[model samples]
Each structure stands twice: as C-alpha cells, then as structure tokens.
Target: MTPEQNRHAAQLAFVASGAELNIGTPEECPLPVDQLVATRGDEPYVRERFSAGLTAHVYRIHAQGQDWTLKLAREKCKVQNVDGQTSFLNEIQRRADLRHLKHDPLLTDRLSAIVDTRYASFRHGVLLSPWIEGVAIQAWDERQLLQLFDTLVALLLGGLFEWDLCTGNTLDDGQVRLFDFGYMYRFDPLRAFNSNGTAMPQFHAAERFETRQYFAHLLRLEQDGERLALDAFTLEKRIAVEAYQGLRAELASRGAAPVVLDWLDGIIATWKRALVNDVSELYLQEAWRSHWLDLHDDLSGQTCTPSTLARIGWLERTARERYADVQRLVVVESKNRLFDQLREARQLAQRWQVA
Candidate 1:
C-alpha cells in the first residue's frame, strides 16, 4: 500500500480495536516507522530501544541534519492498562507548558513541540523529542563535579524551584544539566513546613553515602593542603539526606526496611556533626585521608584487605537479590491491579454490546 494508504489503514485498525482517538491531523502526528524511514532519504541512523520506565519502544535517531528520539507505545489489549500512555501525555503537556520558562544553565534543553501519534497502534500512542548527550552528574570528574554542585545549588535556591534533584536525573558535560522534570513543582515554604515541620532539607542516607564517595574522589584531585570546592555538594547532600531519612523512618515504622532506617540515622548524625561544626571540609579531607591510609596499609600487608574484585562481587550479589524481590512484587501487583482493571472494562463493553 502507498504511505498514506498504509497510515489510513493503521488509523482505521486502531479505531476498530477501541483505541481512544487523538485530536490532531495526520501531519501533526508522528508518522509510522515505515513512513518515517521512507521519508528520511539518507539523514540519520535510527535504533529502537526501551527504557526502564516506559512501555513504549524508543527509537534513537542520529542524523547529521536531525537528531531526535522517537517513542512508539506498545499495542494494548483489553486486558492491559493504558495508564502509561496517559502519563506520557500528561508529561508532554507539562513540559510544553514550561518550555518558555528560562532554564538554568545547568538544565537540559527540551524541544517545545510534541509529535503525538495516538493512532499509530491499536491501543497506544507515540511521542518525539530531542536527545540530550552527557554523562550523569554522579559519574562526572572533579572539575565537572564542582560545576554540577554549584549549578544544582543555584537552581534550588534561585526562587520557587522544584524538580527531582537526584543523581539519576542530573547530567554533566563541563556544566550540570537537570533532566526529567516529570515531578517538578514550585517550592512552597508552607508545604515544606507542613511536611517536615521545621526540619532542614537533607539527602537520603543512600544518596549521602553515594555522594560521599564522589566527594572522596574530588578530594583526591586536589594537591596537598588545597581545599576542594565542595560547599554546595556538602550542603545539598545534608539537606537531601535529612528529607530522605524522615521519609524512610516513616516507612520503616510501618514495617519497611528497619536496617536502612538505622543506617540513615547514623548518616544523619555524621552530617549534623560535620555541618553544624563547620568542619564538613575537614571531615571530607579526613575521610579521604583515612581511605588512602587504609590503601597504604593494605599494600604493606598489615591486614588482608578485600580486593576490588571481591567488593564488586559483593555489590553485584546484593543488587541481584534486591532486584529479584522488587521485580516479583512489581509484576504481581501490576497484573492484579492494572491488567484486572482493563479486563473488567472489556467485559463490561462486551455485556453492553450483547444487551
């Protein structure tokens, strides 16, 4: 069939299959993969992949003329929930609304236009956006790391600012770039006060521990007796940990990970001592020094130290165990809740048709 004919057929099939129709002309929507490929004569290469949080297959297209990412949703059936599609559309609308806002030099730039393709499949939708390039802030080098922390603090304290300021959502080139604004909100003092009631913002213990490792690395980059630029990182880490600890404690009291709660409390104590005493810089310096001293001690055979290989193995095993538990729980819950809802809807529709 011709390109237009093929698209028309797809649209008809989607509608017949009971997919919700999107409000837009065909030209406004993202063309089918075949149509897109046919239109792009020799521009960029396209590779389809999937991300952890998406039900859609994502296509990363690289062209000298055009660089963009395309996501096409998987086909849904009567037994499948389309909440993912709804969430994607909501996120698109939110991003579009904030597209005109002046972004911090640290945030990733997103394109304003969202190409919707709700008629692409029998029960799915599609979206397209520009692909950003950079390593995550967690993986940045010392110079990049300093800039990243600075940028984060500036963004947070500038005005009413709210975004998931986690390591995963931050990217760094020479400067930091905040991405994934799906949970962005305006920072309200009232809300903050109501939530924590005079508690300072802090990092979760896990985040603090992870960031401490990064800080140690940064300390190593400096010469002897030279101070590392870590004021913002230290402050933000403390804030995030405090917030995380409070949340974790609440969860733990309800029979969550009590072990994690204890660990977080210890970390919080450490941060309080370091920050309140204005000795955070010294604390990081000492931690790094102790680490290097232990390394030297290991080399001198004072004790049989765990090799890097052994440490990695331990970490991998721990991750696997936790992930398996999480995966099983998620799969069971999703099937019971989301899939059941869809199945009930389909049964209702069938009964109505029969009546």
Candidate 2:
C-alpha cells in the first residue's frame, strides 16, 4: 500500500483499537485510569492548566513524586480540519514509533531530545509523559540550531516527517527538545521526501522548520534592520546547508532512490551557490514563501492568531515597498492587485482570531 493508504489504515486501527493501543505498562502510569479521567486543573495535584491548545487540554500534574504532563483530548477540536481532528490519535501513533527509535543505541543520545511517552490510551483520550521544565526559545543561537537540526536529521532518517515545528512544540531546558508529534507522520525515508511521498517534494524537513518557526524569528529580526535579518538568515542557511549535505551522504549510502538524492543535491547546490555570492535574493524569496505559506496554513485551519495578522502586515508592507523584489522571486503581474488581496486577507485574518 502507498503511504497515504497506510496512514488511513493506521488511523482506522487506532480508532478501533481503544485500550489495545495503550503505550507503556499500567505500572508506569502516574495515576489510575479512572482517577486520571476525573482530573481537571482545579485538582490539588494539577500544578498548571494550559487550556489554549486546540486539540487537547494539557496539565502539569504532580504525581508519584514527579511532575508529568497530562494531555486529555478535547471533545471537539477547534481547527476544523481532518488533520486537526485526528491529531491526538496521530500523536499517540507517532509516540509508539518514537519509543522504539529511542531504544536504538546508535540514536539513543541524539533522539533523547524527543519526549518519551509514559502512558497513553486512545479510548480514554489521555496521554501522559514526564513534564519538560523548559522555556520557549527566545532566540536561535548556534547551540539551539545545531541541536534542533541534529534531532531533525535523526527523525527524518528514521522515517518520521514532522510537519509542525512551531514555537509551542519546541522547548529548551539545557537541550532543544521536540515535545509535540500531532502533525508528525511516517514515511519511507529512502524512497520518499515525506509522508506524502515524492508528490510534495517542496515540503521537506528544513522547509517545514523555516516556514513554521524560524522565518517568524527572522521576521522579527527584519523589523530591527535588514542587515540583522540577513546575517541571521545567512547563519541559518549555512547550518541548513551543512545538515542537508550530511543527510544526502547518509541517504545515498543507504541506497536512497536517485530521485531523492538528486532532490537533495539540487537544494544543496542552490544554497551553496547563494552562500558563495549574495544571499539577499535567496533570503527574500524564501522569506516570502515561508510567510505566505504559514499564513495560508493558519487561514485554512480557521485558527488565526495575532501572528496571522502580523504576517499579512508583512505581506502588505513587502508588496508596497519591495514590489520589484517579490515580483522577481514570485511572478507577481500586478503590485496593486497583490496589495488589494493582502488587504482582504488582513480583514479575514482579523475576523478569524481564535487565539
């Protein structure tokens, strides 16, 4: 079966399996199943209540001499899409795969950045793991970037494609860690670009990270000055270039399809050439793509937040001030038309502020 068919089968099996899909042993649970279901923020053991999530109610609960994150699925998910609706199940499924990957000695250290699943039950809509005592990455330093890309490379080589790498999904205690897997899916790394196979080659791991998270960081830097933003972009691109080179080498050794190897080679060559000469053009092109695509994702989910409006603002500003550059990169025939469309998008984004 194809990857999509396999995904469908897995989703169906998860929905039907109920308690049979539970991870970890019963002795590993922080609380009894019945008592855990009864828990809410007000409970004394519940240390923190994070109710902002669209798919689940998350809480930091103190139990069994430790704090653990307890996630309970919402009765109705707010994103209004199939992926959003099934995200909890997806998380559970990925956790099962990740658990095995964690046990691999070669990857034990590199994959430690991924959070471990202690207990999960599809029927009860509950997932639990040790609480991460970490803060959101305020800035992307070299250490954070290297660690994140290392983890990402390991994940990709292991056949997992993580679509969502947003700020909320990553944390930094002493090391960068990915704690969310709702949008992560399985694929054949040697044969496919991502879970969708070779059909969507444009949506690679680095592109996902830049679109969902890093470009937003660069956008903030842009407001400071173009020079600062360019410097940061160059730094990120250099790291990405190195990571992709290593990834390509490893994939080739593993007998990855020529199509996959060639795709990686193309990306590497383009970035390498841009790095040697001027990175400004490439920066403008990718920044525009990332912001526009991320905005589309937010609008599609009907889950627009302040960031969505900020992106529209950037689009309008770029259309007015950098029309020539954007046109050079993305084939815009009419600047006025682009600005008008952005204005309309801004209004719609304003109207759909769910966060």
Candidate 3:
C-alpha cells in the first residue's frame, strides 16, 4: 500500500480502538445529562424533534427561557458504516479543538458562523448548543458563496478540513452557518490539500462543495436544461476561482510547500482557461464526477436515499448514451474499468437502497 493509505489505515484502527469517549461537563448544558436523557418523547421541554440527522437525534428544547439544540448520539447511527460508527467520537474531538480556539479573538471572528458548543461528551452521548434560527440554503447567491468561501479559506488555512458540506450541515440565517463537525478533521494546510495530508489531491475544498451540494443544485437546474445549469456552474466556478486565488496567495505567504502551490496554480489555470475558452465541457466533467462520487458515498454508507437513486439512474442512463464522451474525456485509468465500476455501483445501490 502507499504510505498515505497505510497511515490512514493506522488512524482508522487507532480511532476505532481508542479510549472511551470523554464526558462533557454538565455546567455547559442547562440541564444535567441524566435529566436530559430522561426527558424524552412528547416531553413539554422539547419544542421540536428532528429525526433526520444520520448520527444523532436532534431536538429543539425550550428550557431555562432559551432555545437550545440537543443532539444525542444514536446507539446505532442510521448510516450503517464505519464512518457513521465513529462520527460521534470524531465530532467530540473537533468540538474540543474548536473550543480551545474560543479564546483567540481572530479565530473567534473567523468562526462566527460555527455554532457555539455549549456541551459535548462522547461518553454521555449528547451535545448541546444554542439553537440557531436559520433555514437550509435553497439557492446560492453571490453573498452566500462569498461568506462560505471565507469560512472555508479560514478553516483550510487553519488546518481543518470539513469532509461533509451537505445541505443539512449548513443553514442561512443572514449569513451561512455551519453546525456539524462530525466529518471535519485536522490536516497540515501548508503541506496538504486535506485531512489526509498530501494523500488525496482529487478531494479538496472546492471539490467537496461541488460533490456534496453544488452539483445537486445543478441537477435541479438541469430540468431547465443545459443553458441554465451551465450558466449556474460557470458563475460558481468564477467565484471559486477567485476564492482559490486568494487562498493560494495566503497559503504561499504563510510558507506553503511548493507542491501545494503548484496544485493551486494548476486548478486556477484550468478554471481560468475554461472561463476564457469553452466552459461546457468543464461543467460536464465536474457534474459527472460529483454525481458519481456522491452515489459511491451513499452506497458505501448504506444510506441510499431517493437522491442516490436519482444519481444512479442518471449515471446508468448517461453512461450508455454518452459513452463516447464519458470514455474519451473522463480521466480514468481505463474506460473499461470505469464502466465496470459503474456496474458495480449500480449493483451495490440495488442491494443497499434505503427504503
């Protein structure tokens, strides 16, 4: 195995077998852990119960004259996978680290949208935060994109890589708010693209956003057909490219490695060329990648929703229709191999489709 793969393997093993999750202090929480756990179904204190979160049971508790979000870890997470199994523990770790940054004014300012963790304990299986009043983002305007990019740039520069940027994890109140940290992990920003260090170049901040959120939105736009979708993607790419230019300069000023700089330059160059030249092909390539990757994630997690089915159906239909394009332009070791992978993905989706 490659050195990076070996290291990740070691980490997964370590995290899986590590010490019991730490207990968070009850002081941070308005209610004691025992009492909180006791107060359940139809409890007057819980104003709303949100059962959609994959890792935890979420509730809006109206107690102590304030609205608070109470997240209790599931005994078994809905997504039956290793990532799901360890996410609660992972969240606890990230929260602890973020809490340490609370005292720094600069860090606090940059992390304004990140929710204040009132209490979190892996052992207690609960997390508490001041309830944020916001709505899930239905559209990406320039303002929203800029705000998200700022936070992302800050996080990337500060060594945190958030792997999950799906819709539920973000909400828009006047500004974008990010609450979930279950998939945010630390990495050396100066030397690496993400949490796995220099291991995976294919996965980056922009790619994560595209794969998780943007492309799905594009899929919605596709009902209007190519012009609107391409227009939307082109706008997003322009913003992303601008954001990345700033990121490159900041990282470079902070003594980022040459390899990292080169990667950024390459991305910037590609996007700039697309903006100046033909952007349709770029959009097509990224859309295919985004859909394909998301389908894989759903299959692996055994959380294949209707959206996953849509992604699979799109791929299956598109691959046959646009075989020449997928085979010619899609960067894969072998066209035959990619076709095999797609078939395998279809089979897995059939087996693992959630309801």
Best by TM-score: 2
Q: Which is superior by lDDT, 1 or 2?
A: 2
Write one digit per residue (lDDT tens) for candidate 1, span 260-312: 45555665676677677765444444433333332322222222123322222
RMSD to the true structure for each prediction, in A, is 17.4, 1.8, 2.5
User: Residues 1-355, candidate 3, lDDT per residue (tens digit)?
Assistant: 7544564565577566755555356776787778776656488888999878889889999878899999888888878766677788878788877776656675678778788887777766888889999999887888898889888887887678988899889899998998999888888889888877666888999999989888888887888887988888888898999999999999999999999999999999999999999998888788889998888788778877777767767777777778678766686545567668877877777777664
Residue 33 error for model 1, in Å?
A: 9.6
Q: Per-prediction TM-score, please?
A: 0.39, 0.95, 0.91
Residues 4-23 of candidate 2: C-alpha lDDT, one tens digit per residue: 76777768666766645689
CA-lDDT, candidates in order = 0.40, 0.89, 0.82
Report residue 156 deviation for candidate 1 (angstroms): 4.6
Better of 2 and 3 by TM-score: 2
Off by over 4 Å in 2: 1-20
What's the best-to-worst order under TM-score? Answer: 2, 3, 1
Best-fitting candidate, measured by lDDT? 2
In candidate 2, list every pair of residues with a backbone clash.
none
